[model samples]
Target: MNLSVNVQEEQGTAVVYLAGEVDVYTAPALKETLLPLTEQSSTTVIVNLSDVTYIDSTGLGIFIGALKSSGKAGSKLKITGANVRVKRLFTITGLNEVLDIEEDQREEV
Candidate 1:
């Protein structure tokens, strides 16, 4: 599946909404969008993955890089809206404690 990223300015944070699969082919796009945001001040980056279908190691690595980059500049990068399967991946990889991840809960229809 194709990856789609939509970026919006939320309060003082830059929120990136992601959908579809994030793998080797699509990681660059995300990187391009995030790296620049990490370089600045006065804003944090919040990556919202509610609609993301899948994410490979490369994608995870990109997040790590963003975290580091933002940290160097005294900013923060956060993640939210991850499903159980994705949350499991983060836990198994020991990134659950390292990264700020928010569980996604949807209202029943």
Candidate 2:
């Protein structure tokens, strides 16, 4: 599937659910969706990646930039529900220790 993003609110947090491939061709769109949230003070952004089929190095670069941007703005970005492949990428890049990467227990509604 082509990359798509769905924005929603869960409790007081802003959640962005991503589906399909996130590659050199699609990372820019994800960056746009996240840019505003990154500037918000005390914001908590949740990136739900359960439906994401693939992601390349460029996509990972975007996530890393967002993580740093959010931190500087006093905001937080958590990556949740990444599949085995994506999770392995995080571990391989040593981002698991720097970013809030977690397996989500909540089912999609």
Candidate 3:
């Protein structure tokens, strides 16, 4: 499956909306788009995964890299709208504690 990423800016936050699978083949695209945002000083980068059905280790690595960059650049990284399966991956990897993730109340149909 292909991944689609859409970015938008609201106030001082950079919101990234992702759809489809995030794996080895599509992780590079997310990294390219997200890493740069994380480098911005005093900025907030939010990754929305409401429509993201699957995410692999490679994709999680990209988020880890982005989180590190955000720290050094004095930016903040937030993850939101992750479905149950994706959230479980983070929990299992212990990244759920390291990264700021906001739960959305939307149920997947």
Candidate 4:
């Protein structure tokens, strides 16, 4: 299915909550929502994937682009609450080393 993206502002941070599948079909919506936040100077953009069930390479690419945007804008990008499978994708791609991913205590198989 479809990906649901919601954004909330907390202090100086923009938190984006995502659910459902993040594939090529849904990546554009995510990019639209997330990219602008990353472009804001001195802002912190957090992508919360706690409710997301699936994600593909296209979704990962969006985050990578957001990371780059954040750097150029002097902002911060963080990803949190990723499931085991999703976290493994970042690890395998070696993005975990370059991106700031907060550990999620909940584990899923």
Candidate 5:
């Protein structure tokens, strides 16, 4: 699977777009991508998973780890654009209550 990341900064928020499958082989890269941003400042991080096609346990671990790390650092992490399959994973795993996930709304401010 292919992985692509795009980062945008706005009003102290860091928006990251994740495109592709997140599995054991690629979860490390995703963790690496977020570490620097999380360490830089106490910015609210929004990870957009609209384009993510698949995710494995390792992928889920990275997000959970990031959430803990961000919490300790006094920052917040939000997950957005999770498709039905992904959302089901979160629900089935009881992760939906642990992570902050938002719906996709095209309007921009």
Candidate 6:
């Protein structure tokens, strides 16, 4: 699986732009990429999946883990630009209820 992440720091937020598959083979990379940002700044983490093409359970776990870490640090973690398939994964896993997800401007849970 190939994954690419571009992180941009702005004021009080880190915008992470993700692309490619986020699965067991790549989830760890995702975690590692975000860890430094989480530790270095007290800013809201925004994961933008507009360019992401695919994701699996392991990827979901990474997001959940990031959320947990951000919560512990009193920072916010949000997911945005999820496509229909990714949105379905979140819904089926009940992750939509636990995380702040926004698609095209409409907020879900």
Can you give the TM-score per candidate against the true fold? Answer: 0.91, 0.90, 0.96, 0.96, 0.89, 0.89
| Cα distance off (Å), candidate 2, residue 90 | 0.1
Q: State each model's CA lDDT, in order.
A: 0.86, 0.87, 0.95, 0.94, 0.86, 0.85
Residue 70 alpha-carbon offset, candidate 6, angstroms: 0.7
Model 1's TM-score against the true structure:
0.91
lDDT of 4 by residue, 1-109 (tens): 9999999997889999999999999999999999999999999998999998888999999999999999999999999999988999999999999999999977555
Please give the lDDT score at residue 11 for candidate 6: 95
Q: After superposition, how far is residue 11 of candidate 4 from its true place, in Å?
A: 2.1
lDDT tens readout by residue for model 3, 42-85: 99999999999999999999999999999999999999999989
Positional deviation of 36 in candidate 5, in angstroms? Answer: 2.6
Identify the superior model by TM-score, candidate 4 or candidate 5: 4
Error of 5 at 52 (Å): 0.5
* Prediction 2 global C-alpha lDDT: 0.87
Between candidates 1 and 5, name the one with more favorable TM-score: 1
User: Which regions in candidate 4 have their CA more than 4 angstroms from the true location?
Assistant: 107-109
Error of 4 at 39 (Å): 0.4
**Winner by lDDT:** 3
- At residue 103, give the lDDT of candidate 4: 94
Per-residue lDDT of candidate 2, residues 46-81 (tens digit): 999988978999999989889889988998899899
What does candidate 6's lDDT look like per residue over 1-109, in tens digits?
5999889988989999999989999899899988666655478888999878789999999988887788777788889999878889999999999899986464545
Tens digits of lDDT, candidate 5, 21-86: 999998988999886676655699999998998889989999888888887788889999888788
Itemize residue pairs with steric clashes in candidate 5. Answer: none
